[model samples]
Target: MRHRSSASANRLPAPRKRFGQHFLTDTRVLDSIVEALGDLSGTTVVEIGPGRGALTDRLVARAARVVAIEVDRDLVQHLRARYADRPNVEIVEADVLTTTLADLAGGPYVLAGNVPYYITTPIIFHALELPRPERAVYLVQKEVAERMAAPPGDKTYGALSVNLQAVVNVEFLRKVLPGAFNPPPAVDSAVVRITPKAEAAIEPELEERYRSFVLAAFGLRRKQLVRVIRTVASLDAERALDVVTRCGLDPMARPETLTPVEFARLVRALYAAPSSR
Candidate 1:
């Protein structure tokens, strides 16, 4: 089994196309990503898609321990061999989406990754699920980084913006051009830091409802709040108007114009409405 695994690892390409692998090669960008996570002297870090171990090399040096999850079996084998001597580094051969970070780390951990562009959003929200990391630093598509950190009135603000902001403080760190990667992605990428709020804007019990409400509102973002509330909450037109008015929001206001706090208020008002009950 060991011999076969070694053979398989040798045959596979460094950056597999199917995995959407674009390995970060620029040392400066790599340093910037690591720096964004702050000091990791005694911290455990869960790194997603540690392709070719470029970032992992830096992580293992600084972090107390590094649990690097790689989906590719070939890369997993390669990584295990590369870091076999390093007791602090654990190469996990598992899908990051399926594996729980808390279970792998066995305690609190910081999340960092140069995530695949195609699955960036899913990977992020997946990580943000229960037992969230101490903080997360991701090298994601520039557009997505903008959306995550975008303000209420910004053009990039949408359901993603509201949902993420409701729980975490987002910082758009810096942008990386295509040349930074081995097989450069066509589009520019950016690094973003996500730190979960000490006091979430929405309570844990209400998170599901809050996410659903925000998605529903942005689903019909061009429409006025009155119509969106009426459609999504199954409230009558008059009741919808009343709900929006009571929430201190303009009935004619579009969803994009509302802040995360305003969205939470509107959702609570909708839930309280008699028709919604």
Candidate 2:
């Protein structure tokens, strides 16, 4: 029943667990999410995982153009057929993460979706990597949404936080109750607003090194970063201690203790140090 499954006197199949299909069925919550999108106007909006078109209808109405990407082939056909009459809406059958900037069409677009919780990270990474998207809004797992928007020194802050905040400013929009979904997820969901940073806080040249360094530091979170660096690189504790001093970081500081800027400073200092090689 691909591309032909329309709501009939007899409804189509319910949410499928394999697709991680937790369809958002609450109309009030749907309106709230669209409101948070805020003035779609002439802008293009891309909806990821538009299961059963609950949120898709609201989004397509708001934006000048809408592209809905769905991985499930059955859903793609159904969605294509459902919105086939609307020239403004296009249904692309592919994983959202594989989609590139050029594939998204001419200018900056806004991204919105109730994404599958399992692949949220890669999806966020994909959106952040896009050259034209002005922002992204997602209904994600509540705990993860908090971690995505978390600041330095928080327990949730780490590679994901550092990498994302480096490119986008994340804000927790609102929490969504499990009852809002057809097949309620085991955990509650929340919305997050992603606004990309025009200017990076760290030097672009050292971004990868900085991330590797930060990840290495966090690999052994219980130990001081100085100790972890010695384990990750050739630098002995004494020389690693020297690099820490040059970077103005405390010898006893753990990965959780450093800010992104401080971590960048450590990256610069460590690179410049002869012992770091």
Candidate 3:
């Protein structure tokens, strides 16, 4: 079905609850988001969930090409019609989670999105996968942004923090309140910029193991490092203490206090340590 232009008719499709749609309507915030993306002159941007095309309008102006992925059929049709005349903008009708950035962009690209709140973490991790985007700017829930950019020893620091920080430099740009959207979300939102590190703390080959190790550590977060290593590495108490101490981590220190580098160090140590199970 051909969707009418929201702009021409002064009507927009109702925000679908199933898709977790909250159209960002604040023009100031919109300008700030596009500005945060830096120069896109010759860049290809993969925009996730381009609801109502507010950000898309700004992105298309600066970006050489934009592949806007929308899961909602109605929004997809609307976007397709909206950008029909523009050869540079390609509206992809697919779930961002199911489609990889490499597949969509075909090469180096920047990612921008006001993603669904429920799937924000998954989307972030997806973007961080192999053949990663050059840079990514996301409008995510404020607390999730804090968790992403949280430092070691912070209350919000955990598996997500360590996992993302190990590979990328996370910057919490600004906080956005609920009123900025067409239908205000219950919680506040924030913008974050993520740039891949030239030298990641953990090697690509070790990323899966690193993620698993970090998850195990935070699963038993309240416990000491010695205990976490013992359980996750299937080592004896003495061996676990040896490995923890060898990593220069205090045997008594909790997982939440360890930095991404420390965690990567511990992962290497544990991988090298023979199991005593």
Candidate 4:
């Protein structure tokens, strides 16, 4: 019910480099992002880094309720004033990294954002760590998008790819060019949709172990799996190879070559083996 007035009147705040602010001004790309969300008529939408309320306006037009969380104080004031009359929109001044998703929306909701490039992964991880949302859409750096949706053995495959794949079905929606933003970013960006798989369930303890093992393996990515595992899991070469064999993986495989499931299997094997005790 509210609208962004002419910038000449309010004199919009400058995009801060520290906040990684890049205001999306392209109408076509904005429409595509909203369409990608697909029918959010009655769902609460949590938007992170709604710089100058460009994406926020579109979200408000469709979402049942829009909770716009802005970390930058300047933009927060602009959004609050812009949406002051819109009862459906709540402008929350908070850091997305520190704020819990549960605190923002009570029931079923979708998470959307033109996330800061530097903190994109943390934001996605935070959302996924919460009780799963219906879906999450982010306009992140193209490189990050590719990595999040990367398959095993792909050049971009690493810890992010594996950890995200272990829980969500990641889809790279579309490529957004740099010209789309007011002060365009040097690198291009892409929209990504992350949906939690219904059956992708991992217990808390196992999930922790899975994260630890995956991170350690990727930390020594250039090394063979056997040696990396030996160092990370504190196992000798024989024990490391044993875990790899139990997981149906080859001793010569590198960390980046293994799929998320493979990592989980290897972690579980190591945890259950007698030598791990």
Candidate 5:
């Protein structure tokens, strides 16, 4: 005899752990996130990890073009099927890291997503550095959002904080409770807005060097800046001291104490020094 199906059995698909899927189900929160995009009229939006298309539905109505990139093959099919009639929406199955924004949408676009927590930092980096979206709005872990929006001296402030802020102006929109999601993540989530800096804080040519310098400084956070600089840049004691002095930072200051501007200044000063030459 055949058995009758229940709601669980008939449900589209359960959240997958590996994919870090947590579908945003709360309509109020969903509306707020879309509204935060401020004027989406005629704008192109590249949405990463559009699982179950919760935000996709809202985005399609506002954006002139909506390119939804999903890593999970199952969800890709689901999203495509769901929005099949919507001419404005295009769904693609691919890992966000390999996919370039230009390849997805040609014109200026905003990056939006409820990003996978495991790949949150990597996604943010990709969004800011290449194909460089005009603006990015994401639903990320509350702690991660705080770190990205953190100021110079906050406890959470470190490499991620400095790196992102050096490129974009970040804002923490608001906190989102776990109840807002279908699976309900263990921790709360928050929405963040990241706007690309009109002008790069560091010279475009020196971006790589600047990044290396910042990573080194934060690698040994407890040490004085001079010592951390010497270890990372392979500079001697005297050269490190000289570099610190040139940047006008106190010799005893720690890495966490320096702002992004200070970090850029130090990198430039070190590069210009004869010792570095």
Candidate 6:
């Protein structure tokens, strides 16, 4: 809950490993964060974890309004004081995951964050859970950023990669060195920009079914995907294998080997299959 001030010159404070706190102190890094948010001024924007309002100041100057969500109590107080005169900036103290994005940010909006590494995946999904956003700018672990932006053949591809890519186009803005923060972190970080696809990935009904199926397939990742289906699909293993073949997937294959499209195809096949239920 320690908040670093922008004016303080001393090496702000090292990241607290327990809280997953990493204070971004490098101006060059901050500049890139601002730049990546290209032409978002006319619209509303939300920033997660605006420690000391470094990015908040830049965002407020450009956007119609800036809503910043900070969980750290002391930091929220500091932000209120810093932006006391700026009516455009609304600061909220709450956990980003539990806060409904659309309710917190009404209408369409863009999101920015230096998310705690521990909850990166959940937070990303949390943001996407709301109405489609213009784009999301995230400062996440370099490896995670890579995973998020990973192409089909990369070993980094997983349920997360498939899930995110199915709904959005992801691009990495820059790979940040550990030194960019107040206390350098053990791992490198990267700035990634994700824009939700103009077309919904699938119809709402199909999308939920796909999400459920994908989650099941990846649930027992080490086991063959058919094993997961047998447990979750209500279909017997033999029947699930038949559906897997109808969907053009190898019943023995692992979830990582399947593409997002293949997963969607499997969901369609499962729906078509006669169910014992």
Best by lDDT: 3
Which has the better lDDT: candidate 1, or candidate 3?
Answer: 3
Task: Give lDDT tens digits, candidate 2, residues 1-277.
Answer: 2223346412435678887889988888788778877899998888888887878888777789988888887777677778776888888888887887446656778888998998888788767554747777899999999888888889888877876777678899888999999889999999888887877656656667766776777878789877876886679878888888877878888877677777777777766445432
Q: Rank the candidates by lDDT, best first.
A: 3, 1, 4, 5, 6, 2
**Can you give the lDDT of residue 236 in candidate 5?**
96
Query: Per-residue lDDT of 152-214 in model 4, one digit per residue for the tens?
Result: 889999899988888889999999999999789999999999898776634445776787778
Clash tally for model 6: 0
Write one digit per residue (lDDT tens) for candidate 3, span 1-277.
Answer: 2233446423568998898999999999999989988999999999999987999999998999999999898887778777777889899888888898888898999999998999999899989888999999999999999999999999999999999999999999999999999899999999999999999988787888899899989999999888888899999999998888788889999999999999989887766335421
Query: Candidate 3: deviation at residue 34, Å?
Result: 0.8
lDDT of each: 0.88, 0.78, 0.90, 0.85, 0.84, 0.79
Better of 2 and 3 by TM-score: 3
What is the alpha-carbon lDDT of model 2 when measured against the actual structure? Answer: 0.78
TM-scores, all candidates, are 0.92, 0.88, 0.94, 0.92, 0.92, 0.86
State the lDDT at 133 in candidate 4: 77
Query: Considering summed lDDT, which 10 consecutive residues are worst modelled in model 2?
Result: 1-10
Kindly report which residue stretches of model 2 are placed more than 4 angstroms away from their true locations once superposed.
1-13, 130-132, 204-206, 270-277
Model 1, range 1-277, lDDT digits (tens) per residue? 1122244444544788999999999999999889988899999999999988888888888899999999998788788877776788899988888998888989989999999999998898898888889999999999999999999889999999999999999999999999999899999999999999898877666778999999988999999999999999999999899989988999999999998888888766655445443
Better candidate number, 2 or 6, judged by TM-score: 2
For candidate 6, what is the lDDT?
0.79
Clashing pairs in 2: 3-77
Compare candidates 1 and 2 on TM-score and give the better one. 1
The C-alpha RMSD of each candidate to the native structure, in angstroms, is: 3.8, 3.8, 3.4, 2.7, 5.0, 4.3
